[model samples]
Target chain A: MSDRSSARAARAANPDYKILVVDDEPDLERLIRQRMRRHIRSGRYGFEFAGNGIEALEKLVELPDIDIVLSDINMPKMDGLTLLQQIPEVNSDIRSVIVSAYGDMENIRTAMNRGAFDFVTKPIDFADLQVTIDRTLRHLDEWRAALASRDKLVALQNELDVATKIQQSILPDTFPHVDGCEIFGCMEAARNVGGDFFDVIRLDRGCLGLAVADVSDKGVPAALFMMSSRTLLKGAAVGVGDPALVLAEVNDLLNETNDAAMFVTVFYGVYDPSTRVLTFSNGGHNPPLVVHADGSSEELELTGGIALGAVPHFEYGQASVQLQPGDLVVFFTDGVTEAINLANEEFGLETLQALFEDGEARSAREAAEMILQAVREFAGEAPQFDDLTCMTLRVADE
Target chain B: MNVQAEHHDGVLVAKVEGRVDSSNSQDFERQLHEAFGDDAGAVVMDLGQLAYISSAGLRVVLLVAKTLGQRNVGISLCSLSGPVQSVFEISGFNRIIQIHENRTAALAAAGK
Candidate 1:
């Protein structure tokens, strides 16, 4: 119940510190009330009296928010030394200030060894008692603050782990099976959940919709933003023939309340199986590589536009290329090319361009595997900072 | 990353060297802030020696541009080539901010 202690700590007209005073002498309670009257009136301190160790334990159990215990060593039912050991059992955070007689040095040493926070001589000077209470409370404040922040960090980490699982679940794990056309996609996750994601949508008339996007930041915030983008993009792409129009709609929706200033770079394309044509639009994302069955490879041109959610009402344009039988189109996030190595050199677009340049014919799955293997080999032992996602679609023979 | 400021007639040329990624972006932002002043007529970021920049680095540049824009002070960048130039273009940052071929060109067009 540190929570109750914190709430009590914030209230007005309530004591800053609550203390339990235990002593067998019947006059001690009256003397303490008279001595501490100013503290009680100013709301700086509240004192609770207990006749012996047994009464003190009961009082502490009832009012767990009690911060300090001021106890005398010699008592009828139980002594302060025995209560000192058991005080922690009630509340380990409770600081004990032993009230022993002056020159009771042996018992004082034993109390100190037994975990008494501080001690005051028993011809009890109320002034020394106040100083001890103030010092103990100061320490408790620091301890509580540190503990609260640590607890908050632990809770945040646990939530992020859950968020990572939810992010992974939303992505397409199994590519759609198109007759005579092979499709495959893979995402190599980084240590922290990143914003990279890809989706494959099977549309009417044997058409396929594909998307690969990277949100600006990593972790839970990016994951949440990516989820919104994925849902919006999928909904907008349905029954929409124009890739640019779909992106424009999703962008406007995202910018409605995009106060976090986050943005996503997305490449959305739809391929018509009958016409063998692939139409696509880019929102500041890297252009995908296209390889014809004849072994000609080229990058789709870049569109001079910012990532989605940066500017409102910005018109995005669409572009298209005719595909032939056995042609390949590869989509990827920046994590593929920007993957750093031991020399701090990037995997770079040149390496990817070269891989796509190969004249050999490869299936969609084979090409996806080849790209991943190359990136891993290039990175060597370097740590990956972002998730790497790649998707390949190969046009089959007529 | 290293941010070295050189004062010209009416502008401050901040020559940023090395790669600015997520790791040193905060330090990069601090050094860039330290290199420029509110009274300067203009700021020119020389990315000639800059090998690379991630989105985190772009955020620092965006903040500097926005802060200077609000104060009516001029801001521009120069000497971006290859991947760096492409990144600036794709992100559409090239549209909002001015660009020059070199530091001399930026200085000549300073405060315009």
Candidate 2:
């Protein structure tokens, strides 16, 4: 009828479970042990016993699987409540119940406050004790299940964190040290993974390949496509003489198995340090902005072709730009100019070009930072929507 | 930074003040987690009092937003000051995370 009796009935229904009893009185301990053995023999319970809190803790340490502790509040060396405190430190999983002849309100409150499962008066009711054990066991099961799930979630999150780090590591660590070029670049992903990539690769003597690309979509799938496109571009560029031929090969390779309906917009170029010439190809990419030494800037308009993976025989067009001393070229993904500020104003190409007019950025690295800073200033408290990828190349005098 | 949260029309409104940088990113994240964990409702983070935010802070926001996204939870930010708004703009966060000019707008947007 009472809460305690119902709990005992529940435990009696599941008798294979283990419960630990802790008390200092030898006579009382023996009587309790007898009652427990009788219950176990009758298929009503299974029990373990300790004479004091210290011995009880020792038993708990030895057998962590023990499901419940029914303890006396007052004892020698260590009180029942003290043992309860130790249980949480050693293993908070163990549920505890306190039994005492001194059933004062303060003592009961202290025992409960100290994390006791339940408390019983000195004149023990077997029904009440059983009910407490049964309820405690049910709660223990739920707690254990919850803890296991929490552990699993934590493990999964750790794995995701490692994956994110691995994805980042695959990007080029530093810009290639080109003799006649100063480089600056940055990649900002909208998510843990992103689809934009920019890299400068050193080819054979006197040549460096600069690339800025955007995949059709966002997140992990797009990131994978970007990685593949980057690899194929690098591989093809190494052997191909013309930048257009390099992109054609990359597009063909991607188009062959492009089942995800994904495509990439790329501006790939190879600059010759000896000749001060940059031969480039555009595949549905944004026109790159070139800032000359005389404080003039213009967009390098390369005729556009379909994005890579869009068609089997996509023909990319090539163009050439002659870079003199103090000339700079800036290439970026759509994420940059499309970035919206708090007022919903885009950090458009015009803003980016204006930042370059000030002439503060002497090196490519500084140029990249300046552009990024301008975008940051413009967005002003808005959230990022896409991955921002930018690469700047400065031509130095021979 | 100091973060305080209260429930408004079943949505959790988190008020963030001070600078959000590497030093306080963890605290910011913990407060969000606590607020969202309490009620699986829309969250509107008020940033009117925020002075500055670094890339580290940006990362924290992204991480929380992504988590909430996966759970089909809606998150919006309101009342960003000039500096804080710029960081999000440059980082392209403005495009991904919902932003409103004030609390009323953010709350209204979240309702949709």
Candidate 3:
């Protein structure tokens, strides 16, 4: 089918097409009625009459769904070109077709710029009028479809904003106040929702659980997986007091029915301020760095294991490290080190270790902020691709 | 990104030959989903010609893998270049999805 006829067919299921005919000449009404007799007889064209631009505006206000306007260029009260300019103010969706005398090319140009869709010269040709009307109707259909898609996009953006907020709310807002230790954690997603998460959960008898994880994807899917992984880790840690057992159980649980085949790299550590010791296990996560008081820094050693949810019957290996009063342990996802700069260089582990070893970290929060600032500066003008997460714990004297 | 698909021995081999970033990952995902039919026993993505991939591309791969896994179909990757291989390794995606050295190895692993 032709584009015009196809557009008409699509709108045929809707209400009747309405048109406003504006002219000072009373006989013009009779002419339009006679010309559109076939459409009028078939209930396809419904007409509203107006003598001038002011009258047309009044009718348009009354019949807001008037799809088209056929107005004379030189009416007594308000001319058609002025009405064309004003029609958009009433409803930009309404296509205005200017009716001008022959050789009135100047007014037609002005009308076209003023938002007239098309023009039909007087001594109105009925066949030419039909073509313009059909074309205008197709434009209207295209506008409505564009508008519908725009509305859908707006709704989707609103939903994503809410999802981001919900994901943020699920993370720990305030760090637990524990004696002899300072803890702080933060996360930044590349998109509206991120795949990175961190926790500073309070355990029994002055013990704290510190975990930072990165899901292997992005957007909503990663965010969903991150949430479940976060919840499972927290639940498993509280039920069993060991880091290895917690990871082992969480991994097994995720593998039980993980249809997504998604996986997470996590570093889970249980710290006891009373003993100044940390018991931890690594699930293929980036190793956490330790900076001692004497300006020496090194990556902590943990038993090797793969990421969680990838395989069943996997055992998580655990290790322990004694902390000094002035030592700080910094745990981070790969987003920090793998962060690329305009030069395409990564903010590698050595820079992070040097930041702590050089006395840039006076507090846990300061260390986390400084590390993020370093990454941001290093990654200047480059787009972030992954979720960034960090958690820092500093051993303090009692 | 250009994604071409061909079926061989009941396996769907999707050969991606360009960068799959945020701008075109959705289209890449739609094309892959269209290729992943019920009767397709295994899906082998040949990324030998794939120049680069962003997290958005990885997200689509994860989604497709999850859907096919639920349907009891296997998915594998073959012929990743240096940069793409590092990305997969860094994100630990290499551990989750099996990666083969070449298309022949991938098809053999897929039992095609």
Candidate 4:
């Protein structure tokens, strides 16, 4: 299951690894050199000699490429532990290996606490020292690889920002100009990108098509789903006059390759300017409120359809409501009613309806803003869990 | 969320308690499956204590139901509170899966 060994083999094979040997004994350098003579002769490892911790620090600053330091514990100027702490200041990439008297567990533990990568003992077994060196280098290689992957994650976050822009651009920013009425929509996107979106499309013959949909996930995957659903809904809406039929076709198209089992709940409707009637259908979405001209609002009757991409060829029902003068239809996703406070209580439908039922009548944009503002106030200080998207259609008074 | 199961007349009654949102939906699925196994002729999810269920949790329930249905295993739900019931209805889960008013009725129906 682990590819660490192979990764080490591929990366740590030939680097002429540089190690600084720090010991007070003058003869110890020659012994290490003679022992590692073959590795030095071949282009595998290069060794540098330092008499003590201070000298090692100097050599390290002089030769910045030294990868590891093998230091002895006892020295007059400075100790191995002191050098281990200073190595990071000079080059964080370097690791220190401590050498001490055999069976000196106390000093070895202290060396480890001070950031020693590994240790060798006095009367050193050269074979053990070789193994320790290989282990230390392998650890360093994996550490660097992990840091590199972290950088890739940061790059991925930047890509998510681009996705946010694409999602924002997909929704129809400018509401369609419908005579005898005004349409406005706003989506307060959550911190993490969600799949909530609203669109207003100008159809043929002065009929405006409106849609608000919420996909079932968050982040890039849900953003992609939201984009495709928006495109498919708009594509199907242009030719199809019936809200039920448009959704039916979009459902089939989305189901074709829904390997992730993702689904979207859509409320698609078309408004005829001449008649002032809006025919709409629901796809397992929360029913929107119809705020009448007198400020009395009622929840729209659900047309009885499951979410799209769940059951293909599912029959959908549609109904129409005549938009009386001064009437406003408030369309919203669950994010509005389902917005939760720190107390873990949802801003339920009753609260939303009460807010809309107030006396003063507002414009399309103003109505949408009022509802959003109420939800935000209700969830004061609690992080917005989902995209708070709402659309309003206000018929101008005669 | 937590799932407790007790067998009654070949039915595995899973008593789901607490909230099941995106964070714990995976564990909910695992616990439900561990309780159901291959032998229960029918399953009933008792949701009287379940406070909230997000779309993610609903997806899991749908998955279990569809998968078990394909294997000829019957699954139903019971005792969903008002808000939870509305959520299930809005998602149209009530149409595909049977929902009983209480555990007694759920067991009675599953026993048949």
Best by TM-score: 4
Per-residue lDDT of model 1, residues A51-71, tens digit only: 999999999999998988988
> What digit string (tens of lDDT, one per residue) describes model 4 on residues A1-398?
25865654444444468988998899988998899876765656788898888999999999998888999999979988788888899999999899999999999999999999888888889999999998998998899899999999999888888777777777667876667999999898885567899999888888889899988756667778888999899999997779999999999999898866678889999989789888999988898888876668888888888888776788889999887888888899888998889998899988987876665779999989988999999999998867889999988888
Clashing pairs in 4: none
TM-score of chain A of each: 0.77, 0.77, 0.91, 0.84
Candidate 3 residues lying further than 4 Å off, grouped into runs, are A1-15, B1-112
Task: Single out the weakest 10-residue window by summed lDDT for candidate 3 chain B.
Answer: B86-95
* TM-score of each model, in listed order: 0.80, 0.64, 0.82, 0.86
| Candidate 3 per-residue lDDT over residues B7-41, each given as its tens digit | 98998999999777655777988888877767888
Worst 10 residues of 3 chain A by lDDT: A6-15
| Runs in model 4 lying further than 4 Å from the true structure | A1-17, A22-26, A37-46, A50-65, A72-86, A98-135, A138-142
Highest-scoring model, DockQ: 4
| Candidate 2 chain B weakest ten by summed lDDT | B86-95
lDDT, candidate 2, equals 0.78
Residue pairs clashing in model 1 are none
Between candidates 1 and 2, the one scoring higher on lDDT is 1
lDDT of 1 by residue, B1-112 (tens): 8999988877888999988865687798899989986678889999999988876677678778878877988899999868889888877778778888887788788843
Q: DockQ ranking from best to worst?
A: 4, 1, 3, 2
Clashes of 2: 23
Cα-based lDDT for every prediction: 0.84, 0.78, 0.85, 0.86
